[model samples]
Target: MPDPLGPLSTGILAEAERRWDLLTAADPSLRRAVDLQRGLIGRSVQLFETIRTTGVRAWPFNLDVGRLRSKLERGVPLLRDESWTLPVGPLTDALLDFCRMLEVSGAGASAAHISQAIDSKRLDAGSLLNASLARADCDIRDGAIQLGLAPDLLWLTAELAVSPYAYFLQRSLAASLPPDVLSTWDRGDCPFCGSWPALAERLVDRRVLRCSLCAAAWPAHSGCIYCHEHGDAFSSAAIDRARPERLLETCGACGGYLKALVSDRPLDFPLAAVEDLATGDLDAAAAARGFRRPALRKLLSAQTPRPS
Candidate 1:
């Protein structure tokens, strides 16, 4: 019999099928958007795997940012057209809002500045928001704010970080990952640079954490992912212990929170990244109190992946 714990694991696929049915029934649009996002996220996961297993470390997880940015700049036009109406759905609407911000922010920004913003992770959040509002001919300053989002740049930038287009950009850059990288890797988190994770996941029985850049995933230690604090020595708790399906893995020492999903059996799905995106609300709730993914958000930070 095949190792059901592996990527092609049957348990994982069954879980995915079950959850997918529920998701599709609840919100077909969400399922569609997730399907699209999965491709991007999956490519990222593979890239990080390559970096770790290959031992062929290069600049920025062996990525060439300049070349990557140039491609994005050139491809933006192709990504849109007169008849290419933006997708409309819950997540798509959110994505539209984010794209508006990018368009607005990039309008007055020099190409060099735009590139710098992406690189420095200091892209103007306000400008992006304003621009997004402007494109829609709506006044964001007066728009109703909900779900902790303000009519400001910060909200817009956050949207961009998780945007589908950004995922596409990251995936495209990830193609540079060597085929043998995973064989050399010991863990995830942008195998090349060793940066803190954008998110952590529990896929069936494996614990995987991924880097915000270079899109890597590797096995995570049981203790605090950031400080390597392990066992009962470090404080940890789940939001609902009885409901194993949902968990909030928080480390009081470093103030990091990563969600976990417990299942009766293991899974075959790409559980780590999938779970992260699926449990976005948990991330939001954690961030509400100032707890975050415990990683730097600037482009310079992307230059070198940090240690978890």
Candidate 2:
């Protein structure tokens, strides 16, 4: 089967590569990070294509438009719907491939250890993928400890692997919903996956939060997304006076900061990571100022339903 998202994915990869080249040319010091991201993006495309060709079914989310609208109004993430199911087989294959890609990319040796564990029957790819998808932090950490690998490293590998599936599901869910129904979602987290925005794109008149995991885009309010504080404590400043487009939005009330970049349009799936990486200096600057991004808010538990 032909990939449904082929053109969009191809465009994202091409644009990301072009941006990566420009970023590296501007600062040779970023070469290492850019190269690692290049490897991950290439592997992600391959995994996404593989899964797409295998033809996974759409998530069985509630089709009642009224109910979906009510849920959106209540600030409920769609992932909380009990009817949704995960396609474990394709996602598991993606996870295993992602582990190997991590090793090949020189991102870490922990993924190698993970692959070894799987080979030795010490780990199950489906279980690992499920844990990662559910954002079961403690489970992942405990498993990492048992495997003698860094918890963060293992979690990162698993999350990256499962992200393509998340993207696919989110896209399908969004497509199924009426445009007005989707527009009702105004929360800080992703309506589909419940993940927080990696950053926001500053369009001509409004800001659009970009999901870190599923790459979903939604309109955002003008204040601290975490606290909804629009008081004087919320302020924005350009990281470099020369490049006013790149900014750091800080909220003193929550002690949280979000990176914002002026863009002509919303970024596609996976490219949000590239933008996040391209603005590493903003992260450093925020850290220097004692501001930090908040941890992923747990909007839902591990509710992975069995595939029908």
Candidate 3:
């Protein structure tokens, strides 16, 4: 499908326009999120393009497959950490440039300014990079802490740190892993990272869960990927303007909502960041029905946070 997320794609642009129409037709309470999605999509395009640029491969940390297998078999999360050091100077600079794009797009002007102060005087790259790392680390540790951080800045650092591993995994591991390797993990969370599905989809005979982080998709556990509650009692009905391939699936047990893309064909890999934005109306519809994404609850339970 020529990378369904490409912002320049006429198909995707048309899809974006349609989604916006759905959002506008719905209630007004979700305007901020829908508008935020509009901004987020552009930034996601910037990041994805950056990731796919020639010779921009991420680091290849050795994986302990035996351990991963054991954990998967036990329904335990694989211990994935973003500890490998990266070129902070370049990453920070790129992040700032992205924030500038955000400002130009009218997304997060104040947050961009807050992040821009690191290089306000156009100082040496080392100093600015160091400052950026410190700020990024602060949010990774404690999201509640207020240190004049922009949400965009936090997201940028997270992408810079995790996307490499995710990209590397998508390249070397995801496709090559044995199908039986996942026999034991049929729970609500990602067996690889324990992250919940930001978006999900049901194919002809089975469903898939796409991780909010890592952008990895795996077979789902039948119903309620958030709480694993089995039933047809979800608030995920398709409505006006919703395509047959997409809808919102909100679980009543956990008050968790997810965007599901239902299709008759095989499920495709999701452009997680862009898909999240693209499903803004599904998010609004789910929220309007009083269901949340469960990211906050999932965040509070785990000390470490990944993209939601």
Candidate 4:
């Protein structure tokens, strides 16, 4: 039995192709997302390869948040116009239209420039950045219902499968920053990015805080991941006795749960997303015991605007 997500890595690429086919067969609405996904995938590979060449020690992929901010500001107007075009393909057209809708919906200011740049500059840098932006935009449109912070949404979606290391790096940095730094920062298991945990693991023999962002593995005290609240009250239990090694970290006060994977398990496991899915029994057991995951809604309620 191979790991689903591991095999699904190939599936993601296959799915990418499958999506393209579906879009070609479907109507305008369905075509928009699939087109965006295809464009996003193409651009993602370029960005990931570029950043990976920089090595992990390169401060946050040497990505200047200041630069990202400036680009976004300039890109917003481009994102607004329904007629904007991008080189990523027809998806750029679809994305520009989507951004137009977001502006109309009050989700954020119109990013007409961001939309317009889809195929604007013929230069390599412009294409790469556009692809990065498109990747983030598509994910936001798809996952907006689950998590909603326009900027963070874009950042997380770009990192999801493309650059897991950069993803973790951005998240870790965001989490470590004082709230006074970024006004939009959210304090949650997702660190600062607001992306959901794909899975969690407990190195039984070693103490490591391996965050999904940046893939920066570190030493974290043994306790509940929800609030780092330690002690007997934060006990864990699981329904799969055969896999007693697998359990859920249950917090009584917050009613938040996280998957705890013992080090004995294979390292190849897609611990982030798959852990949660495989432990459906734990979720059921957690609920039976009056516990549940700390959804994005709950995390947002505690959001504090960064002080100047």
Q: What pairs collide in candidate 3?
A: none
Cα lDDT tens digits for candidate 1, 1-308: 33211133355545655665666676675775566444443443343343333432222332444533443343221111112111222233343334443444443232233334433445333334223322221233233132122344433333343333223323433445444434333432333323456565566678766554324455676677666667563544455556556767776677777666554433212444455566676777778856766533122211221101
Whole-model lDDT for model 1 versus the true structure? 0.43
Scored by lDDT, model 3 comes in at 0.55
User: Candidates 1 and 4: which is better by lDDT?
Assistant: 1
Q: Who is ahead in lDDT, 2 or 4?
A: 2
Cα displacement (angstroms), candidate 2, residue 304, comes to: 7.1
Q: Could you tell me every candidate's TM-score relative to the true structure?
A: 0.42, 0.89, 0.66, 0.42
Best by lDDT: 2
List RMSD in Å for every model shown: 13.6, 3.3, 6.4, 13.5
Clashes of each: 25, 0, 0, 32
- What digit string (tens of lDDT, one per residue) describes model 2 on residues 1-308? 34445435466678898999999999999998888888777777777777666656644666788987887787777655444445666666666777776787775577788777876767776777766666666778887787787788777877888788778767777777778876877677888777788899999988899988878888887799888889999998998999999999999999999999999977877789999999999999999999998876755444642211
Candidate 3: Cα lDDT at 90: 44
lDDT, ranked from best to worst: 2, 3, 1, 4
lDDT of 2 at 272: 91
As a TM-score, model 4 comes out at 0.42
Candidate 1, superposed: residue stretches over 4 Å from native: 1-188, 192-195, 212-215, 231-236, 263-274, 284-290, 297-308
